[model samples]
Target: MSEHHELILTCPKGLESLLAEEAGGLGLEDVREHTAAIVGHAALEVAYRMCLWSRLANRVLLVIGRFPVTDAESLYAQVHAVDWREHLEVAGTLAVEFSGRGSGIDNTHFGALKVKDAIVDRLRDAGGLRPGIDKLNPDLRVHLRLDRGQAVLSLDLSGHSLHQRGYRLQQGVAPLKENLAAAILLRAGWPRIAAEGGALADPMCGVGTFLVEAGMMAADMAPNLRREHWGFSGWLGHVPALWNRLLAEAQERAAIGLARPPLWLRGYEADPRLVQPARNNIERAGLSSWVRVYQGELATFEPHPDRNQRGLVICNPPYGERLGDEASLLYLYQHLGERLRQVCLGWEAGVFTGAPELGKRMGLRSHKQYAFWNGALPCKLLLFKVDAGQFVTGERQPVARDTGQATPARLSEGGQMFANRLRKNLKQLSKWSVREGVGCYRLYDADMPEYALAIDIYQDWVHVQEYAAPRTIDPAKAQTRLLDALAAIPLALEVMPEKVVVKRRERQSGKRQYERQGSEGHFLEVREGGARLLVNLTDYLDTGLFLDHRPMRRRIQREASGKRFLNLFCYTATVTVHAALGGARQTTSVDLSKTYLDWARRNLALNGYSERQSLVQADVMEWLEKDSGEYDLIFIDPPTFSNSKRMEGVFDVQRDHVRLIDLAMARLAAGGTLYFSNNFRRFALDCRLLERYTAEEISAATIDEDFRRNERIHRTWRLQAGKTR
Candidate 1:
């Protein structure tokens, strides 16, 4: 027991390198990255520093034991062999967490229970007292990670997940975890850039996680400064004087580095609600003095006033999965291009997105695209060089639409009949909404038959939404059906230069055409919906809008009765038209870019509601802070990411979701509902923080055909009545 000395510190999966870096920075020798663990050898001070400074680690583990265990009995034997009295006292509460794969110990819960029982039984047999289990707040947390036949046990130094940086008192929709945010920064080369006067930004800086993380990095501030509980506090070897000395040294390092501020660490968001939360989060991180938060739209944001410094802009934009249509996201990216070219000169920009088709719309030539996992979904972090003179013009060569034959797949007569039924229902819904003055109609024609597609008909534009499985065999077949569904609407497919967005499951051999242009505006016309507004279905794949929000559109149709409606970050004004037709007295749409406002107006005119609507090309939050307009109904669906130049900085939906909802609720009428939605897959509503308002999750109500019943589009809820202090 005394001779064997090997410890492995486990962290989040992708952050192995960061933990290794932390270990090395703290003077720990022989640090190496293994799967999800950082293997290192260090004295107690090195562990203390790692606990104090690492921004991307969940917990700093002091590896105490590693042994081979084929079953639960062996696990117990190995755990009991270590003298429990050396560390944990009989009176101390302890918890065990197990994570692993492929072993007889298949169940994590059972494994954890077995370990706990072993520890307690050993302590009781030796010391004659059994420590109680404290699930919510434990005295010590023991982590066990099993790989193959080996079991590695370590003492967790950092309590809870390190990503739960105390800075975030508030959260937004599907906000990026702090550790993940830090990992992204490290991946983008932010530390070196910050040292060299490079600006760091998140256009959609939801709750300002990226910006705050960047600021903390720039200021050399520890991510765990505000956290009080660390597993080390419960350890017998914890040294108070040494900890104080380490903290004082860290503070001194920050002070020494504070002589000159890093260049432009900023965030920009369109939702007015995000502004205060961003401010609060940045302030909590001790980055208020180092970082700047602007409540503005990304589309029209201008470059920083200081012309000498070139900046690095990073955006995590909405991928049309949760918020709105994919076509409108393209519009958002179109303005993004305009802003990037006009303002971000000699700068490097990186966009982290789970959607590849959406990235193409940015119109910038990507220099490098890295495959990464944003949770379980495979995403790409695309890096681009913003050359103002060279790639300023958003130019693209149009390819001809493929008239080539598709491989035959058996679509039986019964399958075709079911598809026809779905198409008919879609046509019926479209006609009813158009005739009833609803500008946006959620048509379910594509949903009932089997293809995971949602069809929405906007007077002039048709949105086709598609969901492909995790592994797709034939992407062309999927794309073809998507195009065929769009063509079934009778709108001649006029493929935009950057329109065809292909998401390939795996790399395929041979040539593949991704885009086409100058296609005929005429197509096979079919009137399935009640409205006779010419159904111009094209032969190309989806280009109009995303269709998952069909239920949300229906909700808008139901709720827009005799109310004044305001749409924040309004892309193409689909909801605006719905509200207008629902008897909304006046509709005001606010976005940062004039381009989107233009598209919004076009969408409104397509539905014949242009005269009743007003478009304001300004940051919605800034406009709300300045303007005193009250609305009966307000729809706040912000982009997942936006880093615009006309505005001061970037914005994030997850970090800013709660605050945006609060702000919208503040401006809402006495009995109005602020319908706030974001497409963040893991969006968690901070219900406790918003106790002043009544909120109910409407994620179920927002689902459509393109999104399977189990697939959630955006987590939504209705907020009414302000909280009473």
Candidate 2:
């Protein structure tokens, strides 16, 4: 092996330039950037330095040879031509990683097998013991890349990718890879910021990836210094003396860097469960004194009083990937922008997100943007200079301002009366909520027709749904009144303005009800009937847990014990969750919407009710016709009208109730009870259903105290098998 060898350093796509710069900094010669990788020539010491220090690279490969090959036979010949004794001992273990196609090699597995066979045959022909193949921890790792008729073979010198920095033993949801985090920090100019003795903060740091990477950079700590294994550790060509010298140098540098005054590093996460993992990762990186992670909400995110205030605030916030996610994220982005503008005035900000549209919702103009790949997802890092001049007005329409400290919007004549009405309703409902142990319930449901809106409380969070004003009303006047109402609710309810979420509710035909209105996919857990369910106040028209169905859910909890429970048209399966918690023998929840099904699965899993719960994504009508097994207890709550493309046909609860009931009856065991419910305001039960079964209208009984003022919100019926008419 030559003392100077051409090396290839692979990194995540879009990071080739940064890797090239890093190689140049490490004193590698002739550095050139390629797609997703860098090519350079360096002595053995530089390769060892890269393996130990380069934070932006995935793998450091030492090129062994290049050859022209047209088929498997030629590939074997070329691979066998390498003197195996020079790299790997005959008894040592080896693994081959083959990539690319062409030259008749279409499958990577077959290519790897051919390469392995050639190496083994070469050793055997020399009358030496054949090498064993150990894919997990091989003594020598060979990489083969075939393009056209040329093959370039290299030996991986980093064991695993260099991104495995030996710090992250635990992780939060959808964590960013270490190398990707390093690239983001580099692109955000964290190096310069840290060098200037500025602080660093990640408000949404999941498991502290950015903070750990930033701490490493600030302290000049080699990323792989903690790692005990290396690809060249057992390789025959490894120069142990030179490697030891480099390792000692890195250790000395790290010691001096660690003794320097710690950089101001901190992270904030909303989920308490994630904060410990961040701390664990930071401690594992030997950076406990340099970094701190606290469990705190975004609205409370501010620079630490004791740390440097002006620096960089970088985050990879949740990019809405599923239905209802985008709608909730809009508010999050807006809040983030507001916090940066109001609190961290001089800090530079970078937001990495897959949804660029959501980034625009931040209301801060990005001065620079860089495209990056988060695995297969194409994303952008939006950079902003957090100053007053960079703050733009949010997308929310102008509303009357009432920050809870000012004279309430009710000071005006019309606004005063509206505010009085809300106060009265809250007074009435507050007592009921406490007595019933209900953390969430409808507080006001259009008590005064002139100020038509529905106000619901989820713990400390308030969700206000404004009934769309009639077309005959003046648009500007209606908007003014709506804003006034919004301003009054938070003041009268005594909740923070940031905790209030508002949406416009309109009459919908077809799939309009499920259409996304915003990108603030935030869900809050509220308790009802001994069950915990997630309710998203910002995403969809209806929160995942329907407040109007509280009584029905309680009823199911009471009657579902020891029965086979089935829920049809189960939008989020709140009823099924209650039933399962009530000790039902088994539960099957069917819904056509995959979005709601996922929500239901999460709800059930959240309550520790996992075993007997089944969430099926299927049209309830079709599923009912196909299911032959009878359920001891059944609940059917279909939408008023749905013409979803996924449905076999349009569904109208009014016109289809009889047939729907009949199909449901066929799946009900003898003496079983089936509860039917719908939100069609003018719905009437067909007399035919009464004739075929003993049916009784349970609408009034199902309307809890919170919804007593709006009896027409939904209707319910309970039926049992009986003599036919």
Candidate 3:
């Protein structure tokens, strides 16, 4: 073995520059950056230092050999050419991690197996004893990268990826990896801020990744100081004396750092469930005194008054990826910008998000932007100075006078009519809502042709969905009417401007209707017919709970005592919850979307429903085909047109209702009733099927007072399995 070995430190893609800077800071020689790895030459002591301190590197590998190979036989021969006894003992375990492709080795698993065979065969030939394979905790980890006809093999000095600092035991969805988090901090210039005695905060922190990493950097603590396992611990060339010396030095430095006053490191999460995990992670990292996590909303987040120094407010907010709604997310981004401009006037900001367009909605010009990859999703790290002058002011102006009284904005004839109609509708619905005990219902549904919008009130929140204007209408006129309606909503409805969410609703086909409209995962509890449901004002095109279903839910509660209930295409299972609360014997809800199924489970749990209620994530049609159990009552309300990739086939409610109804009738107990509904306006039932089973049209009966003006909102039918009436 050479006294100085060439090392390759692999990291996530787009982080090569940070890794190179870190390697150079460590005083390594010939540091060079590649696509996703850094190459450098250093002695054994330097490699040990890197293993203990390099937070941006995923793995630190020591290059042992390189050769040219064309086929699997050549690969085996080249691998066998190395003496395995020098790296691992015959009694030890080994693991091979093969990456890259080409040169007759296309499958990574096959390549790894061949490499393993070569090493075991060489060891057996030398001493007639072969090492066992341990994938989880290997004594020696061999890495092979094959490109073109070249093969490079290295010994992984870090047993696991360096990102696994052994601090995180729990994380929220789509968590930022530790290495990536470190890279973000480096880009945010946290070291400079720390030197100036400034604080760090992540308003939307998930499990405190940023806070922990920032605390470690500020305190000058080694990243892997708490780790107990390393690849070199069991290797043949293990240097116990050198490792012990490095460990002692790190411990002394950490002790000295811990003796000093703690830095201001804080995190705020909206979800209460995530706050405890962050606290646990911080405590485990020995940063409890420095890092503090609180359950807080973004609207109320502010810098601590005790920390008077200017610092950094960095966050990785939801990117509205799976949640396709961008309109609602714009409001959140705008609010973030407002908060930064108002509260963090002198601070710096870094927002890492996959949606740069949404970042633009912040209304603040980013001075610097860096492109990075968040697990194959290209994202940008937007840096802002957070100066008041940088904020684009006058973006919003008061539509009313400063007299502190409600006054309508002066508008054109069309806009005035729109505004007047909105106020009139609010007056009418306020009385009805109070009498009906409805906290969420539609107030206005495009009452006038010029003003095309659907305004729904969820208690204090107002949701306005603007219908896309026809081509005959001028776009400018439509936009003006929309602005007028937005201005009138908050005043007429007596709600805060921030509580109003607006989305444009167009004629959607296929799966477009189900796509997300935003990433604001804000859920509010609303009451409907003695059942409490969780409805998200932002995020999806439709709220989790359908307002029009209030009547149907009440009907189910009225008829569901001691009856077995089944709900197909059960979105959020609101009806099932009502049935269960109505004392149903058992309730089963089926849907294809895991997102909705999880939501349904939460809704059930919110209402204190027990395990007697079941939620299944499956295509409703497929499940119907396989189900044999009979139910006393069933509810089926499917989308008008759905081509979800998760479904077995395209479903058009008009085309498939007959087949779907027949399938449901097969499982419908004798004398049981089946409620079938669809929102397709032009749908017409097959009269021939009515000859076999008794049927009645309940569309008019199901229309609530809020939707009485528009009876075509949804059509419902009640069918019985006995005989024709």
Best by TM-score: 3
Give all TM-scores, in the order shown: 0.59, 0.65, 0.68
For residues 374-458, what per-residue lDDT tens digits would candidate 3 score against the true structure? Answer: 8789999999988756765533222233532222223445645666787888788778889889888898998887779888888
Weakest ten-residue segment in model 2 by summed lDDT: 403-412
Query: Predicted candidate 1: what Cα RMSD to the true structure?
Result: 20.5
Candidate 3: regions farther than 4 A off: 125-127, 270-273, 294-300, 320-332, 394-455, 458-725
lDDT of 1 at 635: 85
lDDT tens digits by residue: candidate 1, 217-307: 8887777877878886876656789899998988887776656655687788888888899899888777767788887776446557676
Model 1: per-residue Cα lDDT at residue 606:
62
How would you encode candidate 2's per-residue C-alpha lDDT over 1-725 as one tens digit per residue?
Answer: 67799999999999998899998999789998888999989998899999998989999999999999889999999999999889988889999999998888999999999999998998874566688999988999999999888999999999988898989999887999999999999999999999999999899988999999999999999989999899998899898999999889988998999999998899999998998988999999999999999998886788768534689999999976644343246557766776776667788989999876667656678999999999999999999997767766533223224531222222335656787888898888889888999998888888888788888888998787888888898876776576556546655777766677777788998768876665767788888878888988777888887888889998999998999999998988999999998889999999888888889989999999788788888877888888888899999988888887888779998999899999999988988999999988889999888788989888998888989898888989889999444
RMSD of 2: 10.4
lDDT of 2 at 289: 90
